[model samples]
Target: MTSQGHVNNVIYNRLAESGRVNWTRNLAQFSDPKYQQEWFDLMSPKSIGLILASIRTDFKFPMTFPDRVTVLHKLVTKPDYSSDRFYLEAVMYSEQQRRPAAKCFEDIVVYDYRAAKKAPLKPFMVDELQATYDLQEQRKEEAEKKVAELQTFVQQVEDSAGAA
Candidate 1:
């Protein structure tokens, strides 16, 4: 929060991080036992871990206090699943405002904690990512329908406010 009573820009990164962390945990938790163990081991502090290589946030609007915020993340397709690094895109949605407040893009790398160097992403990890991407693709149609509805509603509100 800032003196202006809105969330400071840096906080948006934390919101996106929360979404990415929870998504990874859920992905591991819901996967097959073998894959789950592999993912957990990869994320374990003693073993290889995922690290953020870069992040960029585009602010759409400022969110005021007392707003319920929801963060949603989807896998980004680039560099192929065999690559050591991958990307994710997240949107911060403000329920009170009924619109997105910011968009975040993250570049994540596989790293060997003990070796202190980059590591290749395992096959199981790539499979999980591919599955995740497929799921996102499946959901795109529903998301588009909802987005259209929201856009119509937003326009109505804007026109009414202007008339007032």
Candidate 2:
């Protein structure tokens, strides 16, 4: 769901649009051929049910259309084995202001459409998600290492200049 604004309704719509786009893009990565076919198979099933259990949104800034914005989404929790639920957090950043315009948290459930009930998330699904999270963490560490190396190089150059 979206929070409403007094000026225009576009912001609410934009939030929903951005959230869907982010979810779709992130989930689509698992469909690549290199990933296990199980992930793709689970996602391709027509009977697989997805439901939004809840959405909490906080609007920190007012946004209007015609302005550029960036939306970021991250999985906040792994799927609960017992409950078959997962959580996702999302943020909308205002490009012009360089600050977050809104933040949202969503609770989602996996349902078995054929049985008409909630179902446990398959083990393969959980594994694939964990792998994705690990990849992201690895990239973050690599970037931090590069930054630290650059900082060390700069410090050495400064110290040599002082000794000269």
Error of 1 at 126 (Å): 0.8
Residues 27-119, candidate 1: write the lDDT tens digits: 899778777766766556677788889999999998887788999888888345558888899999999889999999999989888889888
Clashing pairs in 2: none
C-alpha lDDT of all candidate models, in order: 0.85, 0.67
TM-score between candidate 1 and the true structure: 0.79
Provide the clash count, candidate 2. Answer: 0
For residue 60, what is the lDDT in candidate 2? Answer: 82
Off by over 4 Å in 1: 41-44, 78-81, 141-164
- Candidate 2 lDDT over 1-164, as tens digits, reads 12442325445545754575556446656555554443334443446545678878788877754566777777776554464777777788878778988887878777777788888776656766666667767887999999999999999999999999
- Which candidate has the top score in TM-score? 1
